[model samples]
Target: METHTELVEGEIDLKYSLAERVKTLTPSSTLAITAKAKELKASGIDVIGLGAGEPDYNTPENILKAAAESMEAGFTKYTPAGGLPELKNAIIAKLERDQKLTYKPSEIMVGVGAKHVLYTLFQVILNPSDEVIIPIPYWVSYPEQVKLAGGTPVFIEGTKEQEYKVTAEQIRSAITEKTRALIINSPSNPTGMIYSEEELKQIADVCKEADIWVISDEIYEKLVYNNAKHVSIAQLSDDAKERTLIINGVSKSHSMTGWRIGYIAGDETIVKAMTDLASHSTSNPVTTSQYAAIEAYNGPQDAVEEMRRAFESRLKEIYPKVAAIPGFNVLRPQGAFYLLPEVREAAEKTGYTSVDDFAQALLEEANVAVIPGSGFGSPDTIRLSYATSLDLIEKAVKRIDEFVKTKWQD
Candidate 1:
């Protein structure tokens, strides 16, 4: 076994640059915060964790059974580069059945996850200094992926007043000749803000006029609250569909994060290019995952609906209690399990000028771990998740309220 000391000693003059792209990477803030919380909890500290991106629900039972069946049926070999034809056909059916759009298998490319699909597209599409317009309070991975692909990220800050969604005008203003694409994650990760059909129509109009590509991350499409419908950019019009990359997965909806299955539906040319890249790269997502995902897409959706109802109930339970707190400004998240709250007001009055410090102080003092907004390109905020039990959410809100008030006074 290679010990750490021996590994460090033997790799001294290795052709590895201390100054490569990997060296320039910032670690995932969500993962870091989650780890710190776990460490503190292991030491017997009471910690409230509101930083996870996935739902609290377990993976649906039928999918697990499907995985077992796949293994039993000898589905252990690597599939086609894009995916199995059966899975691709299922994806094709899903787009038509769910989103009211049609596509062939050639227009559908599956990857390990939606993140991988987007990053692969970023590397393939973005030239040096090509710009991608990302909305503020965005996913933590967006800027990093853009930089990884050697592109510039231009962020347009959205607001609570505007329902935490970027407008077409903002998109129009942000675009330059260097702008290659825009990544829009509806039912967004940090904010849980869903773009309405009308809102998407307006944005689609702008993108069509600008002739730029849209990387629509629709992973949380099925988790909407109340009557808020998810609008796919691909469903807008022929022109809008021409340049849109529709990214979806079974992760959030089916509580299948570990399954590592996602698909991209878009222009056949781009899909083919991504498929070729993924074929040579990952070859295919896990054979079992692909099989189970087919069952997820084609299986009974009652479980998904049940989970959605639970999330909606929890959202109602948490919203008022969270709003009752003095310094925190929380908008009603439209979908997903997150809350990007403005905590800087109280932090500022208390001399904690940054959200990072506020998060650290809360973690150290109140023993609650959260992600600061600066990671998502907004400095005066923090992101919380209401994905846990109603009891936990209530307890967490009360504890947070008390902590914020007492700490601010000090």
Candidate 2:
């Protein structure tokens, strides 16, 4: 057996071994959570998991039918590395029709998922020491991906009071000479905070002055609740439109997480570069998945509406109940099926010092599972997704309420 040698002082040359860049890469925290949830479930534990970023609902029927039809028609061969012309065209049309931001098919590129597109864009566009502004509590992948691209990540932290959304002033405060990009996730993943059109305009104004590119993750664009408007930063003004990469997919909106078909629509130069990277990397998402994605984009949007309504109902229903839990302060979310709740009071009230401890105790004593806020760049909170069935959320919240009240009173 060949044994690996350990370095003592300086074993040969360490620089030639592995690139120092890859060493800084971190694992995706979202995947880390789902993996932990799976481990607990495999133990035959009744874990009411709220750690899932994907919707619990299955993909829509029309999408599945499209995949089946495409397969039957023998559309299984490898496609153009960038994407199928039909899918790219559909993406272009969607951008023009819905977003009112016109882009040619050349400016649209489909990848595995919105996450993949964003990560790849960073890889191709980022240079050493280029700064990417990320707002906290951001989607866990944003900062990691930026860092993996050898760019410095500048984080602007906000709290529940700010709705966990950053202001233009905050973005301005973080700007430096090396700043190259700014990521904005409207209707953000963990916090479910949606920025209004006016709010985006302010941020775009500052970004325009600084000439920073905007990577807008609009994956949850269709999931806003309370009739809240989800504004695309790119659509705010002509200046913003020229530099925005709008990312969207059928993952959350159509419950097609496994399908892995995501696309980017933006400036021709940036999108083409990203598309070329996609062509070389994964080579145009899966063929059948692209066909399915076409159905998701062009088919009846009613199913999307239904899912959004269901999530909204659950969000409203869970808020009061979750708020009733002693020491848990939940800000009603405007979009996405998540609640980034401050659980510090609950932890302190319950004699637990941290969110990880509180989350473990909840899973153990209450048989309820929720992602610790520590994973989402906030250690004093926990994310509660209302994407599951109402019965499960109801039962979990009840258990959580009972579990917290017995030990903590605040």
Cα-based TM-score, every candidate: 0.94, 0.94
lDDT of 1 by residue, 1-410 (tens): 84343456446745544756566577765666777788999999989887777888888899899999999999899898888899989888988898889888888888998888888888888888899999987888888888888888898988879877899999999989998998889989888898888888999999988889999999999989978888887788888888899998888989999989988998888888888898788888999999999999899999999999999999888888878777888888889888778887778766686778778877878788888887888788888888787777777788788887776663
Q: Give the Cα lDDT of each candidate.
A: 0.85, 0.85
Output the worst ten-in-a-row residue range by lDDT, candidate 1.
2-11
**Residue pairs in candidate 2 whose N, alpha carbon or C atoms collide under 3 angstroms:** none
Cα lDDT over the full model 1? 0.85
lDDT of 2 by residue, 294-319 (tens): 98888888899999989998988899
What lDDT score is found at residue 51 in candidate 1? 76
